[model samples]
Every structure is written in structure tokens, then in C-alpha cells.
Target: MGERSDGDVVLAACDLVVAGIDGPGVSALAGVSLRRPWDEIQPLLGDALLELGLDHHEHNSNEGKALGLRLMARRTLAGELSARELAAWVHDRFGHGLPAAEELARLDDEYDILEYDDRATTDVDEQVMAEVRRITS
Candidate 1:
């Protein structure tokens, strides 16, 4: 793929964001970092993390709790299951909380602009380069 203007920064910071946000890209970016030139990548990473965190808090807040209870009540009334069972089921199926749409939007923005060029550097290439350098020396 063609190089992206912000590819390095995105690649560098993706790992932290993924670990926090539980997104699909998490696995692809397991160990990225914002070292050196990638330091500028922190703003994007921080924005995403902060947004996701806030969304999680909101999703688990008092209002959210009430909504969940209400939903469980309706389910119980319909003879679906007991309140406790419903709660447990919801928790397991939908997670304890959710990220906000704004946070998700920010993530989308970052991902859209990200440059994925030169993502994989094989050890074979490293070995070859080293061997070539040794021969030249």
C-alpha cells in the first residue's frame, strides 16, 4: 500500500489505543509505541483513550444502570428470565460498559488517515541486510 502521511505515528500509537478500546485493530497493533519521532503520535492516542474511557464511564453511570434495570424488568415481564439472570446475561453479552460514539468517531478519524505502508519488517530482511553489510565491510 502507498505510504500515508501519518502512517508512522498511527502505527506507533495503535497498540496503546487498542489495549484500551477493545477494537479489532488491537491484535494487529500489539506492541506499537510512540518513541522518538513517533512522540507526536501521543495526542491522537491520548484523545482516543480519553474518549473511550469517558464513554465507558458514562455507559456504566447511574443513568445507564437505570436503563439496564428497566430493560431487565421488561424482559422479566415477558417471561424471558429473572432479573439477576438477565443482568448477568446482558453483562456477558454486551460487556459491562460501552464506549461513546464520539470516541468511536475519533478512532475512525485516526484509522482513516493512518498510513499502513511498510508495516511488516521480516527478520529475513534484517539478516540479509546484515550479511550484505558484513560482506561489504
Candidate 2:
């Protein structure tokens, strides 16, 4: 493939996150700043993450949690959702408090300089990339 556009990088990073990869892994895979807030980025990383979560939930057999995730994902993509709204939903569902402040700080602190690897794209990456292309197109 040629050089990845910004949208491609954001989509790939979102896919990596949904595939059980975290900040560092996504940064390495996409060679970009995954630590930046989604709102700050052009493609909106948070929206992509939520969308992928919804897709994952739909394809898997998990029903209860998947339903909730799909709802939140839809709300997010519709631009009708907020972090506080998601936090409230999580709290209501799981009865657990959200550490918003700490998590925000952690997000900022998670940046790392990763060496690029041409062979980084696995079979799953290709599948996710195809899905991303279909969605974005």
C-alpha cells in the first residue's frame, strides 16, 4: 500500500484498539498520536472506536453488553453523545464509577515514539481495513 492518509491511520488505530490493542500498540501500528483526544483529531478517534465496538458487538454472540455498546456507539456516531453520557450509562449498567479525570491524564501520558514496521499489518488488520474502507466510503 502507499502512504496511509490521516483517515486510514485513525481507522487502523480504532481497529487496533477493538482488537485488544491499547495506546502504545495503536501508536506503533499507525505511527501517530493515539494519546490525543478524539475531538482534537480530524477523523474523531473516539467515534471510530465506538463504531468498531458496535460492529464487534454485532458480529459476536454477546447480547446484553453488546446491545448497550451498540446503542452508545450509535449515539456517538450521531453526534448526540458525550463522555459524561457514556459514563452515566456505564455507571447505570455496571454500577461502577468512572475515573474520568485520571483516565484523561493517563491518555495524555500514554504517548510513545514507536519504530515503524512494514510488516505490522496482520491478516486481521487487512480484514479490519476492508471494513473501515466500506464504512468510510
Candidate 3:
């Protein structure tokens, strides 16, 4: 669900794999819902995959990448955040198994808004709102 494999794939193909995994739903935009914390999320994946009878190894990579990005984004935004930080946040979220440089490059290639500009001011709240709009709509 996190990895943008293409434009059309919204959720993971493995239905059983995500069964019981508390993730972001449509209500995420309303800011009234809670999602599985990373600490809770990381451990459950193994069991979920096992229960689903799927290859845990194949999916674990993207899970880790997505978790790392979420962590980084939370930390960066909690402090002085910028567009570069936002881009880095998105890169880490989507990068998955790709190299760091490659991940950043992919972000650059995919979206014009992720570009880091020194001229821009850092505003975590505003940037987050912008990001939410960008991703959701």
C-alpha cells in the first residue's frame, strides 16, 4: 500500500497479508483516527505474513523502508522542517530497497514538488498540510 508500484495499485495485492494490520484508511485526512505505531507495526508483520501464507521476505523490504521514512518524517517535522526535509521524507517513504542516491533521484524524477530549495522557509505545519493535500488528492 505504501510503495507506489505504479499509478493504479492502491493496496497491496496480498489481501491476507494486510488482514489485521491496522493501517491508514480514508479517515486519515480527518485527523481523528489512529494507526499502528511503528514499534507495534514492525513486529506484527512477520506473523501477519506467516498467517497469510505469503513470502515474508519479499514484502519485508518495503515495510522497513516505509517505517524508516515515517520515523524520519516525524522527527524532522517535529523540529525545523523544510521542503528538502519533506522530499527526503517522501524519498525514504517510497525509496524501499533502492540506494539513497537512487531514492532521492527517483523522488526527483517522480515529483516536481519534492525539490529542495534553500530559498524556502521551514514551516513544519504548513509543509505537512501541503504534503497531505499533495498525497491525498
lDDT of each: 0.40, 0.42, 0.43
Give the distance in Å from residue 32's predicted Cα in candidate 2 to where it truly belongs: 54
After TM-score superposition, the amount by which residue 43's alpha carbon in candidate 2 deviates from its true location, in angstroms, is 43
CA displacement after TM-score superposition, residue 27 of candidate 3 (Å): 41
lDDT of 3 by residue, 7-118 (tens): 1122342332245443333112112212423333334444444544544443546555544454455544456455465565565545544443344434433445434543
Better of 1 and 3 by TM-score: 3
Per-residue error at 83 for model 1, in Å? 5.5
The alpha-carbon deviation from the true structure for residue 109 of candidate 2, after best TM-score superposition, in angstroms, is 18
Weakest lDDT window of 10 consecutive positions for candidate 2? 105-114
User: Candidate 1 regions off by >4 Å?
Assistant: 1-57, 83-137
Any idea what lDDT model 2 has? 0.42
Please report how far candidate 2 places residue 24 from its true position, in Å: 52
Backbone clashes for every candidate come to: 0, 0, 0
What clash pairs does model 1 have?
none
